[model samples]
Target: MMRRNDGCTILHAAVIGKCYSLAIGISESYPDLAGKRNEKGKTALHLLAAKPESFRSGSAYTLRGLGMKSLIPLLILRTIIYCCIPVLYKESQPVNSAEEPSNSASIHKLSRRSSFANYILGFPWLKEIDDARQSHAVAVMLAEKLIRREDWSHYVHTEFKVLEGSQFGISSEKKNRMPDPLIQATRLGIIEVVQEILSVYPEAAYTFDGKGRNILQIAVEEEKWFLYDYLMTSGTNMDRMLSAIDHEGNSIIHLAAHQESPPSTPPGVLEMMWEVLWFKRVQYDSYPYLWHLQNSDGKTAKQVFETNHASLREKAEETVRALANTVLIVSVLIATINFAAIFTVPGGFDQTTGEAIFLKNRRWEFSLLMFYLAGGLFSSLFTMGTLLVIIFLRFETEDFYVSLPCYYVINIISIFYSAVLAIVACCQALIVQKVVITDFRPLVVLFFIYGLMALVLMETSYVIFDYAYHLIRYCLCYRGQES
Candidate 1:
């Protein structure tokens, strides 16, 4: 019941200490405490919001990735040993009938009885408490209780500007106004907290932070693509947010343009391509008129994009040139290797007819080897042609956006195909030459090669295909609008 000098209650202490079980217990016992603000006008939810580490969205360790995942089995084994030993020891002790029913000891007896009962129910009487799970549970529980009680409105400001000194509680005039939980969560990429707030109170999506930016705007500016995609797909009044502008007169599109390459995106040309794709996605999603709408600085979203992405585009050009040069060398190497393989067939030529000896003896292997070699040579030549096209093209900014990437995709695919064919043809040649028996070892090696090729194909193909899909969709939409 006692409070700290700063007015923080036991609930706040429990949350701050990461004692989620005690926090949950306290909140359940005193629901009103969850709604109470400390001296700083920050509720327990505000504290929870500030500590993103409490939620899964804030932490990097997933359920499968958690270190505890490996330790759970061992902990359970230890618990079984501890539980069984105590039961065995208690069974050996003499039952004292005279001391069984004392009035003051009944509670202790009942506690033991419940423990024994739980032991019989196939549950571990001794279990390790997972602080991460407990903390997340407490966070969700508090959010639900606070929202259901309508206590969240005070903490989620509508138009309050987060002052500079307000965070440190140094501004006596506005010391009571803490950061809004929704805005803080959005800025921190805590989608769980943001989702919980919007699920219960859809109106919270309308709340803005100090910059007059809502959760959607913040997501775009912060480059939280996962959160942004969720908001777009959740049907949480996202269409309305497209028109919302901040104090700087920057709409969601403008904010999207201002974001640098996301950390998850690869550096170099892919980063530049991702930035261009992101801008186009946002521009197409918004009303067409908003595309040209200028911010306070009199800069439209396109201008904002140009200003931010100029260096990225130039770097992307250099990267493409470098990549093309490298792939060109690879293509030539593959061409030469495959070309030499054709002259020296797997088996020596029959001197009488100048025919491949394996052509008649190991017909299938020879045919397959020849087919694979021909394919490899064709693919290598095609890749070389594409690389030349890419190398000679005008490296303008606009070309980097679409033309460069498309040509690069062709070059990469051709190179991959050529490499695979060459490797397969080599394996086939081995089979024809009988260098090694067509037994376990060769089959394993062949399988390993195919598996590795498939994995590389999956990894690189997805990004190329994704970029293409978005570009095509944007073009189609633009053409539809034009018509």
Candidate 2:
């Protein structure tokens, strides 16, 4: 058939619209249609590569129009079963006669052909490739399809061949090939797609793009944490992956050191904390030589991190200084209040005996007041001392992880103790006033409330202490591991 004015044939339009059935039918009848190009010199593959959305939506509409929507579930189930079937059966088959293909061989070939047919017709590649353009919903689907297809090796090779012929290659190996779909998926941060691609084609993870950046390098450079974490834990050879240097001589650590600014809401302290964690994790995961290795710029990983995170370090320092100052002020206020309360006892002193008027008469109440007052006074003093230490002490990065939480816990306990002391002292003052309480019910209620508040304070303090202890232990363990 003659091409349209825009040089797009019927098959080109169908592929562009993601009408797989129509495109397949047209291609089957006129195989030449697959090679036909549009006015922009883009073949059917180029049209499919335009954007995932165009093909995905078009395929769905086409499927519904053809009343094949119900078959999607069946196709998926068949794909799964087919993928799981052992390939060891292929090895068990007897040698085929050269004169004529054996039934088993024919059946195997037919099954492979049928699966590929289903792959092309069932919208397998399109769904994953398309969703990977924007999301990861169908990544597994794409991976399964690729793994299930007996000709997947040939298929991928042919696709690259077509890409090369189309002049998509820029510089290196231009006459040979271009980046595969898997490389493109990794660059796009479609983590599942990359995972699936690597699962089916493990060697693809090492394949570099035009810039000589592998999947791991791209993940670090793009700051895709999901992909990065997955790559780290997915049982890949960490030593090799980390050791890979890009064209610029930047290793994985160097790329990580170039991480961009964190989100604004988490405060600079957390940002710095995460930065430290990443630095430590990479150091732990990679070889010691990586730390000393210089990039193309002749800067080590530490140097790169320091240069990139200088502003972050400054911001973190400012945040910590502000926090410590605030805590110091609160501690001073609580200490002053507690110290003043010592002299201004709840009851007035006797004129001659020079003792609190209620101390002898209400010895129990006076003892309780003194106990809480002393507790608050000591806790506040301790908090103040800790705050001073925090302000003046030069903490290495690792030390802050252990010290900050402990300091915060002390500060919180001091505030709680002071508040409880103030409440108890006020109640004691009322008792000293000798207000008429013939009912006795009010006294019982006050005592119950005070007891409940004490219980709550004790429970909260215990929880904070437990949490801080575990955190410090973890920090110590982590530091030991690093050493």
Candidate 3:
């Protein structure tokens, strides 16, 4: 019952079903079963490498709807807060010198290394084992769990033997070979799993995948910032890792230049920022000469970036245009409304004095109305001026970092000022009209409610614009693919 015709054992079935508890139970009772092979000469470990069905297939639409529900409110809140505050960058602290190890400490380190080596060389299944194609996957998973439970030094020196041929007497050319687990994990962006494998087997960092790409290259290509940052500080040989060139003669910088389209929901600005961040990080990490090094196509890293990001740059320009137009139109409308409100004061003019009726009797209401009108007019004018400058200015890729943020800030401020004006106008009207409310507290609460409604309106407009942009972009992409 434990072994099947296709060489699948009960352990294989358990692993396939992701029933770790059952696999452990079977392994404990039949320890020898760990060495058992199915008819195809594959072990239970191989089954673990098969891809799992994505939960997205069933729940993607629901999740997307939920995300959209929360996105606008969060963005509105974040935008308001961000405009109100400035971010500060902190200087990095210098590293302190470490004291030299004593003779006893040296001896202990040596003993630990020896013990780890012995543990690896002594493991029967790990040594002289053939047909353990997927064994590395199991080893990596176990190693991660062990690292979590135990100390890093315990497995720092462990190693495994690389077997050479098909174990089941099948043609060598037809054998299903497994790539190094570290490379596989790195490609998959499994940071914890890769970290465990590399910590115990530092030499694995030097291993290349089938594409002749190293860990750093994979991290750069995949945009796995967490993994890339980890490797940088992981105390490995940095020079070798940074200097690696893949089969296509593409360096780390070259790989970083190739941008994939971001998920449809992320704003274009954020996607551009991420691409810029990746380029800067890779540039900082690699040798300065890497910038000039050309790939097989005779294009420098900078050239590759320019070529790849051409479409993105165009899209960004389009977004900038749309944003400018939207802000300008909204500003004009607000300015027009405020202009009209100024003439039609909340309180009618005094028949004898030829001034506002509330000017002398209700000075506070008059003052609030004046302040609201003035603020709204000033904000609208400022927004229009900014939009004019943006529309006339030439925005290259380098300019986006500074200019785009400024535009967004101005837009938020304009919306906020307009919202405040609306709230103030509402409150002043209620106060001057002698509404049923005696307590001003309800008016204040109503002001807040009006402000919130304004924010919701502004945010809803942004969401609509973003979705429209995405829909158009998707249609274009689909058409391009079809063509």
Q: Which candidate is the best by lDDT?
A: 1
Judge candidate 1 at residue 124 and give its lDDT: 41
Candidate 2 TM-score, C-alpha based: 0.53
Off by over 4 Å in 1: 1-8, 38-40, 51-53, 58-139, 146-150, 155-177, 396-402, 439-441, 456-483
* Tens-digit lDDT track of model 3 for 182-256: 565566555656666676667667666666677888988977655677888799987767776666778889999
Model 1 residue 426 lDDT score: 93
Q: Which digits, one per residue and each the tens of the lDDT, describe model 1 over residues 1-483?
A: 788999999988987887655665576557678777788887777777787777766653432112222343344454444334322111112244534322111101112435663565444433322334334555666555545544555545445344465312211111114567788788878778788888888877877776767788888888776688789878877656766777677878899887466544566787787787777777777777787788889898889988888787777778888988998999999999999999999778999999999999899889999999999999999999989888787776567568877887787788988999999999989899998787789778988998788766655555555567667866775531220
Give the whole-model CA lDDT for all candidates, comma-separated: 0.70, 0.57, 0.59
Candidate 2 vs candidate 3: the TM-score winner is 3
Model 3 ranges off by over 4 Å = 1-9, 23-177, 261-270, 351-354, 436-483
The model with the greater lDDT, 1 or 3, is 1
lDDT per residue, candidate 2, 414-454, as tens digits?
Answer: 66666666666656556556553535765686677777776
Count of clashing residue pairs in every prediction: 0, 0, 2
Looking at model 3, residue 295 earns an lDDT score of 83
Per lDDT, what order, best first? 1, 3, 2
